[model samples]
Target: MFPNNLAFISSNQLHLVQSSLLSMLKGALHYTIPLTIITFCIGLVLALATALARISGIKILEWIARIYVSAIRGTPLLVQLFIIFYGLPSVHITIGSFPAAIIGFSLNVGAYASEIIRAAILSIPKGQWEAAYSIGMNYSQALRRIVLPQAVRVSVPPLSNTFISLVKDTSLASLILVADLFRKAQEIASTTYQFMLLYVEAAFLYWVICLILSIIQQKLEGRFDKYISK
Candidate 1:
């Protein structure tokens, strides 16, 4: 009779873990995907512009871009998200949680990836620039045709690492009342008083997602290797 009772408890515990994982993963699929995708896309664009600005040889633009990069890198992302989501409302600049999360993450990514991009662009041989000029190509034409293509090949690995990190970071959105995987897990743990189990479940989902992203990153790097070796 005691053995039967122990077996029943073990089965229930397993059931709880399974259900919690499924619930959180469902939220990740519905909310996390969109947040990560939008943030990365916007961040990529902003990062590229910021990178170009830093290297464009214009004092004002370079100064502003430098300040932005410095500020974001110096601060933690949580404080940044808090400023956007909480502090802005005091100034009557109202925004929703999801959009605020997207903005915060984008700004962070912009600051970090800009450095990666700038370094990659600088890595191109100075002779490439001379060759472009010798061929009567303007800076814009050379950048669009030759420089950017090779720079992109060099930047792919680090940028892909950034994107994967963004996937896990999206969990922070839950703090701002966004219904992401971590938020769902928080709700479940609060009701059931199973914080450890539910959080572990959420972590499992994040791990699975990151694993997939890593595999995709490997494939992309392999593809880019062809261009890099030439």
Candidate 2:
């Protein structure tokens, strides 16, 4: 028999337990969701810009992009997060932890996603760009209407994976007291003294989030498969 005080075992405790879970979910939605979406979108834009710069005829732009990607990809994300979160405030930037986390994650993702975008763009037959230009589509027009559509198909799967990783990475925000899911779990576990129960529940919640994201990723892949074969 379990300890009578163990919150996990009692029928009447179910509502209380669920309320805690609901609180965790709300925290996740509030803190983690914004971090994920903002980082991914910002990263995507940076990737597009970097990819274009890398391929552009300008040598200075190409070199700048190369340096940025190399620096970002070479550094540990933990260090980058620390720099953004703690290091900048020392220099008077004074960014909030949540926004700093977003910037760090976004820049990190941008470095990796830039390579994916560049590779995707390069994988397209040069003839596609040429064809678009032959039809009087300017560089921007061709890139927007012709090249990017195809590149997006190639980019979606990896980008989805990046977002999944980003979701998991949001746990790092707990270090800064952002009150995300894991932080809430830690709070509950610390107070309730049911470390194993709370931790297992937290782990299960993380797994469920990943599973849901995986399902959506698969659907997105299927949707984009209409454009790219492999």
Candidate 3:
């Protein structure tokens, strides 16, 4: 009976790990990918606007950009998430947890990305703007043709870092029943009552995903460097 008992325990552990991994992958598809794409797109737009505003001739626009970046960078992302998810409901304009999480992450990403964008834009020589004007090119035209392409290449490394951070940040969604990878692990752990083993497996999966992302980031940087170095 001793080998039979051991076999039962081993099979049960394997089942828990498999279920947890499957559920985590399933939840990641539904919650994580959509959240990352939505948040990153929204943030990219906001960052562009904020960066433009900061570089505008208007003082008020610059001040607004400054305040936005300051506030977002100064505050913790977790606190911002809680306020959007929990506190906002008190005002009667309730958002679902998923939407709230997206909004919070987008705002945070925008604030950080704005600085990178502005720096990238500024890195171009002032003579480029003068030359664009010499050819009768307006600000927008010059920016589109001459500035943004270069700035985008320069910003890729930072942007990759932001995306990687967003992937990890998705774990925070568990607090709101968003059923992300972490939440899947939690569910499996409760059902199997093998918290440590299941959680360790989940962590391993998370690490693997992050490692793949890191490899992609490195390749991107290498490509960008090849173009920029020339």
Candidate 4:
């Protein structure tokens, strides 16, 4: 009876760990990747527009962009997530939790990335702008063709790092019921009474994903360097 009991306990523990791992991986696929990609893509667009406005000759547009960035960067993401997910619905403006996560994250990313982009654009010497204008290109044309390409190269590393950060940050979505990897781990741990084991395993999975992303980031940076060298 004692041997049988020991075997049963070991098997249950193993099964619990295995299930936690599997569910976390599944959640990563279903929620984490999609959230990161969608938020980053939308945020990049918003950032680009905001950055341009910041640098544009128009004072009003610059002021508005500044306000947006200030507001976003000044607040906690957790609070922003709460307001978007819970607060807005009180005013009869409804948004689903998944979309609320996306919008909240996108706004956060946009504010930070806009400054990165603006700095990258500013890093290009003023001579480049003059040279383009001298070649009969308007401000818009020069920006579209010449300035942006150089700026993109400068911005790539930081933006990629931000993207990796965004992946980890998406774990916060669990607070709003997004059912991401961390959330899945929470669900498993709650049921199995194995919080430490499951939580550590989930963290290990996050580290693995980040590690893979870091490798890819290095590769991308190297590729960019190669192009610049050529």
The lDDT ranking, best first, is 4, 1, 3, 2
lDDT of 1 by residue, 113-168 (tens): 99999999999998998899899999999998889998998999999999999999
What's the lDDT of the predicted structure labeled candidate 1? 0.91
- TM-scores, in order shown? 0.94, 0.88, 0.90, 0.94
CA-only RMSD, every prediction: 2.6, 3.1, 3.3, 3.5
Ranking by TM-score: 4, 1, 3, 2
Measured with C-alpha atoms, the lDDT of residue 97 in candidate 4 is 86
TM-score between model 4 and native? 0.94
Cα error of candidate 2 at position 225, Å: 2.3
Clashing pairs in 2: none
Q: Which pairs clash in model 3?
A: none
User: Which stretches of model 1 miss by more than 4 angstroms?
Assistant: 1-9
List ranges where model 3 is wrong by over 4 Å. Answer: 1-9
For residues 1-230, could you state the per-residue lDDT of candidate 2 as single tens digits? Answer: 66668535666345546767987898789988788889899989999999999999899999999999999999888888888878888888878888888888889888999999999999999899999999999999999999988888888888899889889988888877688888888898787776776677777888899999999999888877754564
Q: Give the Cα lDDT of each candidate.
A: 0.91, 0.86, 0.87, 0.94
What C-alpha lDDT, on a 0 to 100 scale, does residue 197 get in candidate 3?
86
Candidate of highest lDDT: 4
Please provide, for model 4 over 77-98, each residue's C-alpha lDDT reduced to its tens digit, 9 standing for 90 to 100.
9999999999999999889989
lDDT winner between candidates 2 and 3: 3
